[model samples]
Target: MPFAASLASAAQQAQAAAGAAGVRIETVEDPERLFAVSRLLAEVWATPPGHDPLASDVLRSLAHAGGAVHVAFGPGGMTGATAAVFGPPRGHDLYSLIAGAKQGGRGVGYALKLAQRSWALERGVATISWTFDPLVRRNAWFNLVKLGAHAAEYTPDFYGPLDDGFNTGDRTDRLTAVWHLNRLGTPAADIADRPDPDAAPGPDGLPFTARDGRSLWCRVPEDIVAVRGADPARAVAWRTAVQDVLAPALADGYAATSMTRDGWYRLTRP
Candidate 1:
């Protein structure tokens, strides 16, 4: 199937899922709807009142400038939102700046992502790129395995120190996920044969520093959120370990290809 068709099919599947959960996705341009989305973002991130990441005006401007501002509504109210910014040299690419969903909205996040993909495709956008903390196992699985996005770059402290509740104590390192809007499908499933996370900092932790090799494995804590809250030192250790493994390799021309089932990032050289 062509890229657009494939994306459309994926979006259809996601829409069905959303509908089954009593959720619907819509494009928001009006100030009231956009303000609701901004509030949802702050709530999802647990951002303090004075530190709203996406102000209402910002979302309004983005919607007016041809960027996507997809809002997902569920039983209670606004359940999720996906905001993208149009830019880059190609003009056919978009950077997904922020996306989040409310608690208990099981498939709302994926649905919003599919909606964004469809929205971008209709407007001739070829790719959508976003960043996420590599240590978040669920997010890694969602972006890499479930959504079929590939990690193209790694930046240490990408956003400096994010003060949001989710990122309070940790360095803001991130893996840049390039969702080739045209590409959809699991790249590898059976290859991820590694075991689940263990306390040892070997395969269960961060992989050893990348050497001259075609492929490398990077591991993250099984539950970084819990670890960050209970053991700040361990969380910092996880941060340094991942930085040591990925920052160097990514700088040396390696791209994170996929994440394994056992919380490992598979990095490979082109």
Candidate 2:
């Protein structure tokens, strides 16, 4: 589709998503609204007092410089927020820095993302990229399957040791997700039939190797956050196991194409 037509379609989709989420999306420029976003994000991440992922002053600066800082407002006020900045000069890409939605708001995160996509498409940006912990299964499914993004790279300890509630004790192994603006709703095909039944098991009896050369399955903990809280040691072991399998595969020309609902990642080589 042409740029104008594509942007129009994206705008419609974003509007529909926001309506379905029971929220109103807005590109925030006011300092007070930006501060609200800061607080919302801090609460979502369970950050320590006075420690927010992105401070309001920083958000103001980004907004002033033409970056996007979108907030979602439901009946209870601000429920979600997302921030993205332009990538390298002439890169034609936007790097989404952070996004968080309050718990129990159905489709709120999805609405925020679609709003961000429309914002990017309107500016002629061709892609939006962000990083997420590869061990998080629901996030993998959301980014790769629901949003039609693809994993481009895997980096271990990408952010070092984060002090936030979610990343306190685990390695920050991340997968870079790239969303091509033109390919909305078209994710890479799932090639793996099923996790190899007879494959050798890794930590927690999860499959880690590619018995077949073209593709293979790697499993992650069903609920990594709960696992982290209940058994930190086991969580760390899961991290190391996934890193051992996925990092090498991504480096060796394999891309994680899709994630199963049950926490299996299908890493495939073209």
**Candidate number of the best lDDT:** 2
Q: Ten residues in a row with the worst lDDT in model 1? A: 203-212
Candidate 2 overall lDDT versus native: 0.86
How well is each residue in 1-270 modelled by candidate 1, as lDDT tens digits? 876677678678767867866788899999988877888899999998968889999999988888879889876889999999887777688899999998888888888888888878877888888999988989988998878888868888888888887899999889998888776646653443443433445423444333233577766778888888988988888888788778888888888777767666777776
Candidate 2: which stretches are off by over 4 Å? 186-192, 206-210
Stretches of candidate 1 off by over 4 Å are 2-11, 187-213
Give candidates' CA RMSD values in order: 3.1, 1.7
Estimate the TM-score for candidate 1: 0.89
lDDT against true structure, model 1: 0.80
lDDT string, candidate 2, 1-270, tens digits? 777888899999999999999999999999988888899999999999888999999999998988999899999899999999999999899999999999998899999999999999888899999999998888988888889888859998998988888999988889999888887664434434663544677667755554465676777878888989998998998888888788888888888877766677877775
